[model samples]
Target: MKVVIFSTCVVDLEFPNVGKAMVEVLERFGCDCYLPSDQICCGQPTYNSGYEKGTQRTFRNQVDALLSVESDYIVGPAGSCVAMLREYPELLKDDPEYLGKARILAAKTYEFSQFLWRILGVENAGAELNGKATYHRSCHMTRLLGEAESPYALLEHVKGLEMVPLANAHDCCGFGGTFSAKEPEISKQMVDEKVRHIEETGAEILVSCDPGCLMNIGGRFNRLGKPIKIMHLAEVLNSNVDERRITYLKQMPV
Candidate 1:
């Protein structure tokens, strides 16, 4: 299958390695992956802020870029942006032309974990990272996209990963794009509570699919200088086991 990688803006700018990790994991699984250079924002910011006209630039930009790729699928490590693309037709309700095109793009979009665990049927995707970890279920993945189990399914294969239940894992991390800017105090408070949940998990790694949540949670962890590690889902999937396991695996590549 030919899959195009849509590295969301946050992942592209802050956690670029997540994008690389995604490409690596996909390639490891034997898919023909293409990264289109001209691809820009998915227009979530403008669309979210009630600026349909403002989004025309980015929305139009994305359509133009991907339309040239000739790929059968477009995937991203984010749920929010995909959800935005999926629901953006409402923003273009008056414009039948753009709404039709938006619907076409939305139908083909897939969140990375969803693609890996469901569409790709990679129950035990051959990636193994040993650690106690807690997953922060981003709002987009849970509420918006309604894709709840893919991450757990993918994580089920990580060599020795202990999946601890996060208390209120369904809650928002408060990195709501413009939400953070307009209400900084509320956003900070939400993240503070989220950090407590991570601590409660006693997990060495705090993993999430969205970089916005990662950034918010990671920021607090850093400020507290907690021994916790914040990481993207792609990072976890690309992760191989430690030195001892690699030596053992090469002796018998599972």
Candidate 2:
């Protein structure tokens, strides 16, 4: 099947390797994957901040970029961005020209975990990792995208891996994109609480599907000298016992 890698803006900028790791996992499954270089932000921040007009440009660009390749699926690593992509139909409903294309793009888009566990029927990508890891359920991935179970299902199949339940796994990491910047104090408090819970789990690593959350919580941990390693789900899934063990050790704050 033809798959388009819709690596969102954050992964493109800060964690480019995560996007590559995602492609690595996809290729392992024997799928032809193409990275759409011209793709930009899904206009989520602008749309969330009540700037509808600004969303149109990014929306149009993304629609044209993804639809240009007649692929079977457009898969992304971030749930929030994919959720925004899914909203394009409503965002452009009044504009008859792009409305149908928006819906088609929305229908074809799939979050990484959702595609792996649900669509691709891949519970195990034959990856192996030795760690007690906990997953932080990004709000958009769980509540908005309704993909609460796929990540866990995939994690369960990883050889030599131990998945633990995160306390208050559903709580927000206070990195609601602009929310962290707008309300630094509140965001700090929220992420601090999140870090505390993560520590309580006693897991060597904290895994999340969203880059924003990982950056926010990981930044707080870094400033406070917390040693916990923060990682993207794709990175973990693309790893083996030797690679993952070294990763955990290397990421430990010195």
Candidate 3:
């Protein structure tokens, strides 16, 4: 199957490797993936900030970029961006010119995990990771996009990987884009609490799909000198199976 990848701003800017990993995973599954250069932000930040009118230009450009590419699916690693992309239909519902285009794009767009497990019926992408890890059910990916089980479904198949339940798994990571910047004190408190819960899991690594959430929690881990490793879900899914076997043998507890 051919696919057009929507490299979300966070993965494009802060974690380019996440984008690369996503491409690797998709290709491993026999997907012909294309990353269009014209794609821009899905206009999530401005729209979420209550500036729907201000988001029009970016929204239109992204809609065009996404629809112009002929592919079976338009998938992205970030659930937050996918959630926003799926919203374009509603955002342009009243505009007769763009409404049809928006709906077309939304119909084909999907989050990476959702695309892998739900759409493709993939149990595993042959990933290997041997470690106790906890998944942060990212707010946009879970509550907003209503994809709570897909990531876990994919993770469960990783050889030698133990998945732990995060304490208060449903709580927001406090990285609601501008929310963290606008309310520093509250954001800090919320992230701190989140990190504390991650620590409670006793997992060696924290895995999540949204780069924004990883950035928020990873930033606190750095400042507080915490030892938990933050990993993108894509990276883990695309891990080398040989190295994973080695890790499983060496790291498995007696």
Candidate 4:
């Protein structure tokens, strides 16, 4: 399968290793991956800040960039950004020039874990991590993107990883893109509560599918002098992989 990597702004600028892990995992599953240099931010920061009209160009640019290469799918590491990409058709519906193109782009885009479990039928990526870790369900990944199971499903098969059930796993991690910047005090309080729950789990590692949440919760743990390690879902799945244990539900199509 020909796949294009949708490296979100945060992954490109801040968490580059997450993007690398995503590509590595996809390539391991027999995908021919391509990273288009023309790709940019998915416009969530500006769009969520009530600049809908101003984000139109960004929406169009992303559609053009991802489609620049002929591919079967566009996969991104961040569920929050992939959810934003899935919104392009509606966001650009009035644009006669790009509306159809936006629809096509949205249809092919999938979040990393979602693609692994759903499209690729990967039940196990042969990853092994020795520690108790709790998962933070990002607001956009669950509520907005409606992907509540894909990450957990894949995580279940990781050898030696003990997945702890986070208390109030549905709560937001207080990293709503621009919401964190505009309401830092409130955001801090929300993330503080999230960290408390994580600490309650007695988990040595905190895992989340969204980089924004990891940044928020991990930053709080750092400032508070807690020793929790933060990891993205892709990083967790790509770690200590055992080639002999890697198994898929079905074979890749020819």
Candidate 5:
């Protein structure tokens, strides 16, 4: 399948490796991937902050960039950003020029893990990581994108990896984009609680599908002098891959 990669701002600015890993994994699955040079932020940072009017141009720009090349799918590493991309249809519904384009863009977009499990029918990527780790479910991914299982399903197949249950895994890490910036003290307390729960799991590494949450919780860990390692789901899934063990579902599910 031909895939267009939607590189989010966080991945482009802070977690370039996660984007690279995502591309590697997709290519491994025989996807012809294209990264649009014109792609930019999905406007979640401003839109979520109640700047919907100002975010329209950003939404249009992203649509134009992703559609610049015809592809079967538009995949992204971060669920939060992917969710934002999926909202373009509704966000621009009233725009006569962009509404139809927005719908087409939204229809083909998928978060990295979601595409692997749902579209590619991949059960295992043959990754091996020997360490205790717990996953943080980002609010946007779980609630907005409605993808609560794809990450866990893929993670279950990673050899030598121990997945621990995170306490209150559904709780937000307080990185609601500008929310963390606007309410620093509140954000700190929320992330502190998140870190405390992560510590309770006794996991050596923290994993999450959303970079913002990882940045929030990981930053809290750093400020508190915690030694826990942080990793994005793409990075974890791309580790020590064994080609011989890679397997896909016998049939793609509806």
Candidate 6:
């Protein structure tokens, strides 16, 4: 499949590895992924903060960068950015020109898991890594885009993955983009709960669909003392399966 990747500003700058991992996985899945050099922010922050007019200039540029490619879809590694683009049309209801573009972009825009499971129509992609994992259902993905099963469906077919359910899974990690800044104490409280759930699962890798949530919770895990390693969903799926096919002798739990 030919597609263009919409790398969010956060992933482009701070979490470049996430973007790189996304491309690697798509390539492995037989996709021709293209990146637009001029792509910038998805205007999420400003738009979410009731500054729709302020977001127009950036949104206009985003639409242009995405339309520059003649591909089947515009895929984004970050669920938040994809959801933002999908929501743009409603926010731009007053302007038909931009609204039309936003609707077109929304039609073609899809989150990673969405594209993999829906468009590609293959779950259990030929990846086998033997280990227990817990998936963090990102808020933007679950609440905004209503994409709940895509992540789980992908994990079900991972070469040797055992998905452990997260406790209180629907609760937010408190990292609603700038919401953490607006409410630090509450955000930290939510992170505490999320980390606590990861510990309960007894999983080595705590996987999440969004980098932003991982940033908040992972930072907290780094602060105190935690052994659990955090991984973006793309990174987990991008794992090199060459060595993972080997099974290790299990030690009986006492």
Give a tens-digit lDDT track for model 3, residues 21-94: 99988887779998889888989888888998989988989998877779999999888989998998898988
Top candidate (TM-score): 5
| Candidates in descending lDDT order | 5, 4, 3, 2, 6, 1
Per-candidate clash tally: 1, 0, 0, 0, 0, 3
- What candidate 4 gets wrong by more than 4 Å, as runs, is 250-254
Q: How well is each residue in 164-240 modelled by candidate 1, as lDDT tens digits? A: 98998878888998888889899889988988888988899988888888888898789888888877888887777
| TM-score for each of the candidates | 0.90, 0.92, 0.93, 0.97, 0.98, 0.90
**Residues 49-147, model 6: lDDT tens digits:** 788778888888898889788888899977877888898778678877878878888899999987877877655555666788898898888888888
Two-way TM-score contest, 2 vs 5, winner = 5
Cα error, candidate 6, residue 219 (Å): 1.0
Q: Please identify which of the two predictions, 4 or 5, would achieve the higher lDDT against the true structure.
A: 5
Per-residue lDDT, model 4, residue 128, is 97
The deviation in Å at residue 165 for candidate 3 is 0.8
Task: Score candidate 3 by TM-score against the native.
Answer: 0.93
Among all windows of 10 consecutive residues in model 5, the one with the lowest summed lDDT is 245-254
Q: What's the lDDT for residue 233 in model 4?
A: 89
| Residue pairs with clashing backbones, model 3 | none
Residue-level lDDT tens digits of model 2 in 82-163 = 9888988988999899999999999989999888766777655667878888899999888888778878877777777787
> Of the candidates numbered 4 and 6, which has the greater lDDT value?
4
Relative to the true structure, how large is the alpha-carbon lDDT of every model? 0.80, 0.84, 0.87, 0.91, 0.92, 0.82
Misplaced by over 4 Å in model 2 are: 241-254
Candidate 5 residue spans exceeding 4 A from truth: 251-254
Candidate 4 TM-score over all chains jointly: 0.97
> Of the candidates shown, which would achieve the greatest lDDT relative to the real structure?
5
